[model samples]
Target chain A: MAEEITTTEEKTVDKDIAALLTSPPKRAPEPTPELTGKIVKPKIVQGAAAHYKPHVAKPEIQEKLGFPGTLVENWQEAAVAKMRELLGKYKSLQVYMDICVRCGSCTDKCQYFLSTRDPKNMPAGRAELFRQVYRKYFTTEGKIFGKLAGAVDFDLSLLAEWYSYFHQCSQCRRCSLYCPYGIDTAEISMAAREIMDSIGLGQKYTNEIIGKVHELGNNLGMNEAALRNAIEFVEEEIEEDTGVPVKLPINEEDAEVLLVTPSADFFATPHLESLVGYAKVFHQAGINWTLSTTAAEAGNFGMFVGSYYHMQKIASRIKQAIEELRPKRLVVGECGHAWRVAYAFWNTLIGPFDMLNQKYPRPQHICEFTLDLINRGALKIDKSANDEFVVTFHDSCNVARATRMGDKPGGQFDIPRELIKAVTNKYVDMEYDTIRERTFCCGGGGGLLTDELIDVRVKGAMPRMQALHNVMETHGVNFMALICAICKAQFTKIMPKYGIPMEVAGGVHQLVGRAIVLGAKE
Target chain B: MSGLTLLYTLFAYVAIAVFLVGFLARIWKYATTPSPLKIPLTPAPVNSVGVVYRMVQEVGFFKSLFYSNRIIWIGGYLMHIALLITIVKHLRFFFKTTPAALAWITSFEIYVGFIFFGALAFLFLMRLVIDRTYYLSLMQDYVLLIFLMLIAATGILTKYYVRTDIIKVKQFVMGLVQFRPEAIPGDPIFIIHFTLVLLLLIYFPFSKLMHSGGIFFSPTRNQVDDAREVRHVTPWAVKG
Candidate 1:
């Protein structure tokens, strides 16, 4: 009874302080405690994003992925065990858990933290959510010192915090660039998610998509016949727009190139437009390319969840497609993180691609293919075809900072800008700090693209939008060219919220489709 | 031998043992751990030589910290450089005759203690003043910085103010290395500094200070970007 009264008194005191801070009196001090430790900084808003948790996965989705159907009765036990398993499995997780000194170099680096002013959205702060639980259950200092050493027991509240903040991270690796130790919070986010999933607490967006890939070979759950129909629709759409006969082949044996693109290209706009671009690029270059329904998707959400098993299962479809179709060359389309998995992890996931021609990269980017044609002067580009709109490229996070293109150090940045300039007369760039390896996220990468997380998504996109706002003022930059399907989908949905047109978001290849000149056939 | 001397000696050996064995255990864990994937943050160097250069830039010059935030880079870099020099220059205590390079660097040692003291104070102030860092700082963070500052303070005082007998201090340090327990100089500041350092050493391997060894093991920094050219395979990740 005494404890209850004291708790109530403390609660009332906190309420009084909150009221005083929000609705200030003339002057009475910020309770001495609030303003004393921190100098009046508005950038440290607590609880700003604490409520913005994404929807959890339903039991059916959980069971489909071979995980437990619900949050287990022994969730805390399972979670700690999972953490131990991950610590043993991933050297990245193990090393990262030990090394961070919280120096604040990366505090301002994460966009979510920047836009939301929520300290937990900070890279180190977000990683600390997981690290707190890691300490109590894993390390000696944490075991002894407990909260003094930044350790907290694995509890429901911590799990709730993990779900909210871990999904908030786009796994962009932007903070890693600035971190003195290169402590990638994206790696930590993935590990936190894996632990959550082990306790039957999975995010609906990423897990459902992974399950869909297993069921129907794509994130969209589009089956073999439906995928074929979508390609045929693209072929018709292309003929209608270009007045040129372009063939989008499916399941074609003896085709020279196998095009495995993100499923969004077949369904989503601007994405579909880029699909048209890929078809036209192949048609004009006089190269043979085909889509394989068996491996219909280039986007691998498995990588998002940090499940090597699912990542391998999702990517092994491409291997099956190669065995069945025997395409001499492999080409990937405009999807950022998927391209990262394809470029960086494909060898490990599905290896010894001796079947494919060794003359080219095992899995080539579609940008590389189109750029090579323009360089060879085999395909003519009419730069003025896109003269109406001033364009800028949004470097997808995975491509810019996680994986490379064209074998150059920053080819991911250079190749797209180079491709855009070759095809478009008017091209501008956003602010320097928010472009290339330092580029901001499209606000919806890393499986945060679900509608439930739209509030944080819109908030997260603010830094990029603010950068975009700058380009618009100085250069009349209207179009934002993107290479990732997630970027396209994200910016299209989010541009309107920020008082810009949705159509401003598009693919690099969408411009290529506009500028390519199909010469009179020989 | 007095009980205090024997106790101090025993604790000193224990601290040294914990520091060495704990640090190596952490390093061995990092070194032998299999990185199942190539996850170099890109625009990364494609070859091993480039990776070595990247590591050099990270470790030798604090290049990433320099790029991160100028204020932190200033504080952190000074602290590290001063600490490195101070550690090397103090080798004079262990050496019967100091090496030429050690003697030459010791000439700069006058400013190192002050610089170190200033840097730790700067870091502590920064941690307190910065809203983000203040919220992020665990008690261990502040406690560790204070320990370092206290160490610097006593070392500085002994050099310029209290003036402990240099020969006795050197004899004491050398005696520990040679397995001979000698009478420690009885200055209060000196004893406080020495005790704090021993406690820090015992705490180091069990704490975030392992970042000193762990940074080199960071896959993001250490791994080369040759995933396509080289089929890098980890033991557990290989499929049947």
Candidate 2:
């Protein structure tokens, strides 16, 4: 009885703080009604429009962007040398050359191929380009009867073709599944991209994003102040919705958990709701969690850019943030590629972190977090809130099968489904060919989420759109909930184009925001 | 039965057991290993027609077969296909005894024997004569190839030259399959050859031969490249 009274008093104190933070006397004029509608359209949003527009190369900006190019002294020469070195490494290129039986099983497997309806996008042809070169360089018949075998010399024209063909690939391991010999063309592409980037021929957009991440500590140029303001803003929004002032604690000194998310959420819509979802859960659970303005983003573009150094450097910011905050656990935000890089590679680089005097705890994604709450019976959610539509999950490639076991690294997918079941009415899966490891790509993977690649992204997203359209047409799926920030942003932008006007929620966290009945008496 | 034939049968059964156990074990391990990432890294198609054209060209036209190191690609594939088809054709023996409608697909085993033995001969010659290949080929690789060639050669000789009693051969095999007592092969050479073949079978699961099986489990090739778009959470991913 005494504990109940004290809890009520504490609730009253929180309500007082919430009142002060929100409903500020003379609240700023409704964000100018123009910005509200404009926010949904990338073109209408001036900031996003300007950011997305193809960067007009300015001499000064170029000067700032310019750096001593990669280790290769010359682009073409170095590329040739690298190609020769790779070709020479294998005792017999036979394992790679003869591996492709070309059952055409992998033809429809590429996101780009499906998106563009182009044949070269097929993994078989991409490999043939290299195979031809291998033949010419190493085979006797290829030396004498090159045309018969489609073998050719590694010339400047071929090098140019390699650049064009290679960049078109996202290095997504989708084709690897259908490949009979387990040949990952993506690994080959990574090596190819690294070779190209070494010669200062890296894609401008990918390089710029990597540069931006380096400069501002995020893929977007969101600074510490903007991040803090975004967190504070989301906190207010959650308070308005729940009558509970959820703390999106930013850089709270000595917090138990350092929750890191992609900066895209602060600026984007669907993921913004996801942010609120997380805040609401922490508020209800009375968990000690804080968001760091620095190293706020979970998505790292360095892996896309083919820079090992950049990947390590980008991960270092997170490591440093964790060390400085000394959080008991680091919670990763909703970003797929970021999670893959973090989970797979980060522990190896900035690690053996004995200097921190603590074993680096494995990071938990937000989905894993909510599921834990549900499993522990710590949070209650009303299933009625989600009864309107039949939902299906689109598996993010990074989360599903990238690790050693090639399954869920954290045993996480079920939590999202449980959360969905708790809130939504009916859940259905896309046909067997779709969903799980067989699901379609959002087309904007591997740093294609930027505005500059909208056309390409939309085209690539066609397969997924078609699959989702088929599901919705057949089963009436209204909402597509995904965990990756890029998927949310990509689907939000491209799904509507294909008449699939479904809203993307960033995993189960969004449901918690609307469904978790807060302020319930013990 | 000659001492060589008995010794050969003993070694052959042991080899087959090891190969079957190892291969099955590896496959079980692979299938159970979970892969959830969908990062499609396959290069984009240049055009739709081009992709199909390439597939047809590579698989049907044997474009990949016309290698600079022609000896291995051509000889290796031919030998592999020949051996596989020959084994499948040999299903006549097992099926004929099952008390069902035994269809004689081919009565003349000689035709099947020629194709199998001929391909093996070509492969062995390529390995021996090809300068670069011979230099690079490991001892185990050569030994495995040689062992297969020898098995095929001995099987051919037992059928066409020696004309070993088919009933006796059947009885011996059936006894081995039933795990019962039976007389081993009378021909010492046949016994030696049979033993070597068994050793190859036992070694099958442990060697690079598993590549034929590991193809299904490789995360790189088998997972669709959807990581850029969909969020795949494995049923077994780490929880809080």
Candidate 3:
């Protein structure tokens, strides 16, 4: 009888595990608000995502980034002071604080809101966490009217909400696109994070990666030897696959171009595939390009956390690499926020690249570089090489909405698709409204791509997944091409949870890697 | 001048002063606030001229709103357009002789008032009915919407139900504009409309209504997307 009881208990435990794995622990899947191929306005559910925050950074990780080592005494006062400091420092913060009319245009625009059904995830609602504090402290109306002015005082509960909701935002700026005032929640989320960090609270995933980058020169913390060994393996993979000894030279000074990519490219699949593609493009184009050891990383977590100081400190390594290598030009690899920082913030954070060949745009996107080579007849692309995969390009939010590629307007959108078409025989866009500026985030970006927030990440990806599922049904699309490393990582891990194969996530250059005609220098 | 006329003249001057000073102060603050980064929301234009044209679409046509939600767009666009026509129609009062354009604009007549009322009413209902919008709307939001509704309601009533001495009302407004006091019209509807207008003017810069001018200063809307070509730097950037 005792043995029989033991067997029954074991069976019950197995059933519980299956249930947990199959369904969200908290609630059944929401009936997705009837979407119109445009916006999905989920019914509001308060506190829906309150449980899905990232792990807080350790004291040491916090200290490494120049934040307080722990929750300091008088945390409220310190947080308010930091808000004041940021308000004075960034005009985006100040304007966004006051100008939001609480219009509902942006309410349905956020992926987090649509997935979690969390009212707090609404772009304006997420921003209000900080805006409430801003109102309480800075604005005269808030000072007098308080809650009536849509402002609330800083307190434990509000801080908790700030931590949960701000971290939920990917800082994709998709909401900013629809906002009449262009009130960006990315700016607010960043400031909220900066304030939290100032008061000695920070996220572990971003801060630790940033700390690793500062110490080991990459987010993955692969030292020079490990990095070198990994690339050698990639080089071997290339030679074996294509019968070409295409070199991915590292730290070779005086090369014509210095390529800086996110460290995930060194070892991570799909990312590494793109990295291989970069080498092939240079090899065929016959440009003398070298990856630098010092500035090995391209993604900046500082931008994610909204700390310019950390962003610049992390970005300075690339500038140091540029100085040490003395390359005539700089080229960035397939990473989203890295491209944004390189294309937009690098000149401001780092400076006048008068040293580089002024004839070329100082830092060119890999897509631009590859496309130019293809356009100029400098390289050959065998379009039929990628026939096995019916591919669709996912426009990374940073690329589509934050930064541009070629000189033309909407170049960011056109350039990637142009590059994809040059290499692939079969290409399909997911949905018209879901492409270009209206593209949903790949569910993980802006440093929220950590394992601890898998539920948040998976649910947040619902909109993108549903859209992908639609295309997969109609067009038999087996591949989703992406440019961002975080997007790549997020989609690979989270896609399977939604019952889509993880292999559906492929890099744009992974396609390029297959298509590029190596040893065919035109 | 009668006592009511004298009292209104004083209130008008005060209201206009607060409106002008507050609006300018907010505008000045927005203008002087330094934008340390190039964060233009793309697909933004690359040059100054393109930016101007984009701003024209955003400000004049509510392009972003139109693209975002057609229901909200219809309500917002009509409301703002109605207000614009109504403001233009009021030009007849300020000018000694109404311009041909003003006469043509006023020809929209009670249609403008009805559209204004209808649109304002739709938006107010939207704020209450939409669950997401309801969650987002604060007391201030509802209060402002209802206040505007009341303003539009009174204006409509004056045109349709309680006909006022609008000619005398215009004369009184002209007197206020020219700093020459005239007898105020003695209609309750006219008094309420005039008082509401003055209060809204005074409240404009202090309230969310400053979106009128704030729209121009939004860096994402205003700045050109030429970060790659230009080495834009903040004054406070770390020096080597």
Best by lDDT: 1
* lDDT for predicted candidate 2 compared with the true structure: 0.60
lDDT for position A63 in model 2: 34
lDDT of 3 by residue, A275-392 (tens): 9889998998889999999999999999998888889999999899989999998999999999999998998888778889988886899999889888998778888999998999
Tens digits of per-residue lDDT for model 2, A1-522: 999999998787556433322211332222111111111101111111111112222223223345324223354466666666544332112234433444344555676665454455666656656766765665543666675645677654455556555656666667665554546666566656666665545555677777777788887787888877877787777777767777888778688778888888787878887787787777777788888766777888777755555676788888878777777777777777877775565555454334332333365566666767767778777767666657777777665545311123224455566666766678876666556655566777775665655655676676666666666777877777787888888888776665556473345467666677677636
Query: Tens digit of lDDT per residue, candidate 3, span B1-240?
Result: 788989999999999999999999988888877888899999999999999999999999999999988899999999999989888877889987778887886776467888888898899899889898888888878777777878888888888899887888888888887889999899988888889989988878878888899989898889999887888876776555
**CAPRI tier of model 2:** incorrect
- The iRMS of the candidates, in order, is 0.8, 14.6, 1.1
- Which residue pairs clash in candidate 1? none
TM-score of 1: 0.94
Q: Residues B1-240, candidate 2: write the lDDT tens digits.
A: 557556655765667777777778767756654442333223222234544554544444334334212444565556666666667655554442743333344443446666766776776576456432343233445566678778888777877787677666667777666766367657766665666677777767645566666654444434443332234454333221
> Candidate 3, which segments miss by more than 4 Å at Cα?
A1-40, A520-522, B107-110, B238-240
Query: What TM-score would chain A of each candidate receive against the reference chain A?
Result: 0.92, 0.80, 0.92
Q: Which model is ahead, 2 or 3, in terms of lDDT?
A: 3
Q: Which stretches of candidate 1 lie over 4 Å from their true place?
A: A1-42
User: Candidate 1: what's its TM-score on chain B?
Assistant: 0.96
